[model samples]
Every structure is written in C-alpha cells, then in structure tokens.
Target: DQQVKQNSPSLSVQEGRISILNCDYTNSMFDYFLWYKKYPAEGPTFLISISSIKDKNEDGRFTVFLNKSAKHLSLHIVPSQPGDSAVYFCAAPFLTGNQFYFGTGTSLTVIP
Candidate 1:
C-alpha cells in the first residue's frame, strides 16, 4: 500500500481563483510534510512545508495545512495563474527511516 496518496489526479481552475489539492497518509509518525511543483522534463522544486507541530504554513500565494489526527493534508493556491499549471506533489519524511513517502501528484491547470 502507498503511504502517501493524492486523491485527485487532476484539477482545473480559472485564473485568479483558488486551487486546492488534497493528500493523505497512512503513517502516523510522519513529522515533516512538503509540497513540490514540477514542470515537464524537469525535477520537482520545493514549494512549501509544514512541520507536525504546526497546523498551517503559508508562503505568498501557497499554503499548506496539516491535520495530524486525520493523517490528512491539503495545499491551497490563491489567485491561481496560468503559470501555476503543473504537477504538484506532496511528500513526507519517515520518522523511523531515511526513506521518504510521496504522493502520486495532482496535475493542476489554470485556465486563462
């Protein structure tokens, strides 16, 4: 079974709107959560992260929310732009091991 999963395979939003992506994990010991955005033929770049101690973290138009009890998290992008279109992935570092768990990723398209 996958430790981290992205429930939505794709999402579409109009420009200047909000784009929300959801993620879930089965592991309870994950302490660090990260979101990455990737363009075609390139490696993913880190966007935002939230520690387990905090429920929310934000950077400009990107925000991440963590719900430890539910083992769930979500990424929110406000005023979504056409340039924001990409594959967004959520990842969690394992507490007991060096390996990391990553979600399948959600493809987001911001329509002009």
Candidate 2:
C-alpha cells in the first residue's frame, strides 16, 4: 500500500513549459530528501531528493533543489511532457532515520 494519498488539489502545466513543484519541512532532523512519482497502474517510485547538504540534483529534464536554511525543497521540470503527468510526493525521514513520513501528494497534469 502507498504511504500517502494524493489530495484533491492539482497542478496543470502546458507542455514544454517549466513546471515547479515545491515542498517545505519543519523538522531539523530531516537530513535526506525524498521525492516519489506515481503513475497510473504503477507503484510510487523514487524520483529525486538529494541530501539536505547538497543544494541541487538533476536527472535529464528534472531538477531538485534543497534549501536547508529555509527548510524548503523544489523540483523543477523543464519542457514538461505528457509522460511526466503523475502524482508527485514529498517525504521526510523520522527522527530514528528508519521510516519516512510522506505528504499527501500533488497531482500534476501536463497539457499537451
């Protein structure tokens, strides 16, 4: 079972435009970043969430940035595509650093 459910809220972006998704954290113990993307008929898979120590990480058209001082995280998708349409989730690890606390996801729709 998925750890979190997607909220009714959603985001719609035009294809080939920049799509920015943001997340914020209040816990200082959050050392590592965790983001997941879920597609229809598939389980949520790890996307990109670099460690808090690192400011940014990128994979192809997707980029993730972490701001430790501000306790904020952002994922940037350049040239967004229809294939990128999915539910994106943000997660933080527990104090014990064993399990993770997942946030209600944000549904993203890419307008082709």
| Per-model TM-score on C-alpha atoms | 0.96, 0.87
> What is the per-residue lDDT of model 2 for residues 8-72, given as tens digits with 9 covering 90 to 100?
45899999999888787777778887889999899999988788768999999989998888777
Output the lDDT of residue 4, model 1: 99
Local distance difference test, candidate 2: 0.83
- Model 1 lDDT, full chain set: 0.95
RMSD of each: 1.0, 3.5
Native RMSD of candidate 1 (Å): 1.0
Off by over 4 Å in 2: 1-8
Candidate 1 versus the native: TM-score? 0.96
Can you list the residue pairs that collide in candidate 2?
none
